[model samples]
Target: MALDEAALETLGLGTMWVRRGAPSGQGVVEDEPALEEPRAAAYETASPAARPAAVQSVEAKPVAREPESQSVSAAPTESAPGDTPVRPVPPETAKTIRIAPAPEPEPLDEPAWDDFEPVPPVGFDPAPASAPAARSADIAALDWEALEARVSNCERCRLCEKRTNTVFGVGDRAGDWMLIGEGPGENEDKQGEPFVGQAGKLLDSMLRALSLARGENVYIANVVKCRPPGNRNPEPDEVAQCEPYLQRQVALVKPKLIIALGRVAAQNLLKTDASISSLRGRVHRYEDVPVIVTYHPAYLLRSLPDKAKAWVDLCLAYDTYRQAIPNDKARS
Candidate 1:
């Protein structure tokens, strides 16, 4: 509670009493002076030197307060035991002032965390498992005669539009040894059979060295039956279209062992993009059949130094082919 003006004056501190003198009687307040002058005058002539002699001579102590209802007003009162003098209120000092009740405190703006419902922790789904691709259904169903017929009359790709002839594979149909090349060349396109002209003769000589012969236990075929224009390597789409025919050929021959005669042949036959250098000198599996990669006769002709390596590849193929044969006792 703030000190009353009379209590402050008793304490020797200046009082900010608004009245010019104490209010004298009921309805008898003095005329208002300028508000600024009254506020300024409230502090005047009230410095340390001007303090009342009675207050300055005595030690200060807290004054005891009466209850609000029994508080003294502006009349002089006798001092009680250990009690300081207090002024009494003027008669019926304007009926006790009543303060209004304070308004209820406004609610806080932010919401409490406890007010919200619990949320579930988030989770993620696992990725789908990868699987090997399924082989072509239509191609798998074709037989020797049906496969050959399909390949011959096939206009399945752009190769068909400019094809001189579809070299629908040659050599032994029931051969145990199969060799595959990339596609037809100039002579093979004209002849309607694979391995003709110089490359064919060289292939024949190589077979003779291995004690094998064309149309004996050996079958010669190609990945693409039709020649690519100017003997450029077959485009990916061309190879895709022609792959079904080659797949059918592999199914029909059921060779004891197969040989891939060039980079393109090895890559397409193996269904891989690995280089010939990485693929050669090993027996790799083409589903059930074992395959060996070798330099193509045309390639060997150009790269004559590799002919010795080709012979080594042929030896590996021969060993692989022999291993595929059952033991004599097992066979018996």
Candidate 2:
């Protein structure tokens, strides 16, 4: 027997409890209204659209038992005349279940402070800073000839006191490749070039390997134009004084790629004290231009095995330069 829709509403029940069922031969005890006036009014006034679909009520009467084959958890019941479907009393019921959430996990056992090494925060530089990365407005504004003349006679630092000739760099003023070295070596100071002597020869071979000649399509320069005493690395003041000249050179040449040779060259150009081992095989930026790092030709002359690694860095620079092209083409 299926109960009328109005009867289900009056009994504070929903369609989920009003499923069709086989007749219960046993007669219903009472058809008296189950809900009092207040309850019936609440159920009637609640909009049908707002009601839950799956609720039921049990009367104080025996529901027909499910077939023996049915599971105890899902026993089916029969309906009596003038009543909605009846169901068996639930064996176990939960009026409400309150579960406290699991507690926050305790932090794992930390080792003693001595067992761990300290890590500096990101961008934490311990090295003493050199002078401001000062740019010479004068240098920035000078044309090629004026800039070259200024570098040749530059006496701005102690290096100028001892250098034989100021190596004013050589190559295409408007080319797309620039080479920066640390400072002038003995051969460089004498010959007025960035890379010369045996190192210069090795550099020439390396450039030919990439099909770029020294002054043909590449501009070669040093961090400081003058040689440091005894070919020592350029001092902080020397590099600081000369940075503007190099910056101007970069601004003028507008190279697609800048290859920094060795540790001193890499660190000074990048404004860091990091070693070449960490800097190599990676592309850094000089402002917006791409800079690649490699072993100095002088270092390669002594450590022949590193020549292979230098070759790889050059290849990376070549590939990067090709990518900078408007259409992925690089000048030879």
Candidate 3:
């Protein structure tokens, strides 16, 4: 119990006392006089040299006690020995505070894959493969005739009316590396081939640099067959209509590596709108084949500086091709 002022002064210390009582059977208490107040001695001021005496007060208050009865109550009653005190209606101490949960974050709205468009870097070329024979064998098994037939009668979109011929792809059908361009240009539309014209020559030279041939180790195609008048990007509807033909070719030929030659091809095939800089220098998957995206040959023809980057993509494609079909037996 806390020490009263009288008890503290009498003890000359901060000490407190817990009153004790004998058992009910042993001894009974009779009415007694009030406790006498301790005498307070004078006001002796402390000198700088003499410090106040050390006092250690008991920090804890009294523990719970048993109940007791009283004749009359003036102030709040305290428990005597062997009696529990009526717990003072516990002081309304502030209750523990709690913080509410944060509101759920709003969900983001990302564009769908089909809606994305891939844009290739100005300067870059895809790599060539080593095993042209194995690659060609795989492609030969697929029906290019069926693919052409499908494209020939394709009236899936309005472009069918404007198209001269169904530019049904060109180059090595059996090639290990497939070159996919955006769509046909004037020359390609007229010739029913992909990458014909000055750009095609440059592309051929690029293939030759890596010891590749046009109709030998490399195959070329585009996302759309018809030229989008004045060489504009093909419309979504046009690409949507023509895509099945390309998909069938890819499935039949099963090229070990697919080199998306431009933003349009990369965007359409990879289903991503990220720029070529972001897509380059990394390996991507197209169905079961490894795909290395790079700039279009036309773009490379326009910007000579990008040749080095194109070389990098080419090297990457070659490395991936090697990894895909390790040996002759693996192709079987």
**Which scores better on lDDT, 2 or 3?**
2
The list of candidate 2 runs beyond 4 A from truth reads 1-135, 327-332
Model 3 poorest ten-residue lDDT run: 34-43
TM-score of 2: 0.58
- Per-residue lDDT of model 3, residues 64-136, tens digit only: 3222442223254335767754323221332767999999999889888877777658765444533444444
Q: Sorted on lDDT, highest at the top, how do the candidates line up?
A: 2, 1, 3
User: Against the correct fold, how does model 3 do in TM-score?
Assistant: 0.55
Tens-digit lDDT track of model 2 for 1-332: 12455676578442322124633322222233543344445555556753322112222323443334544444345455776655433322226668999999999998988877888899876544422322376678898899999988888889988889999889888888999988888888888877878999999999999998988989999888898998888789788889889898899888989999989999988989898889988889996899999999999999999888999999999999888886435443
Give the whole-model CA lDDT for all candidates, comma-separated: 0.75, 0.77, 0.69
The 10-residue segment of model 1 with minimum total lDDT is 23-32
The predicted structure with the larger lDDT, 1 or 3, is 1
Candidate with more favorable, higher lDDT: 1 or 2: 2
* Residue pairs that clash (backbone atoms under 3 angstroms), model 2: none
Model number with the top lDDT: 2
Candidate 1 to native Cα RMSD, angstroms = 15.6
- Candidate 1 residue runs with Cα over 4 Å from true position: 1-136, 327-332
The superposed Cα distance between candidate 1 and the true structure at residue 74, in angstroms, equals: 51
The count of backbone overlaps in candidate 3 is: 13
Over the stretch 1-332, how does candidate 1's per-residue lDDT look in tens digits? 11353566567453222222322221122212434354334345346454443233331332333333653343533345665433333343458778999999998897788769665457643333211113256667878887778787887689998888899888888898998999999999999989999999999999998899999999999889999999999988888887877777878877888999999988887879999999998889885789999999999889899999999999998888787787423756
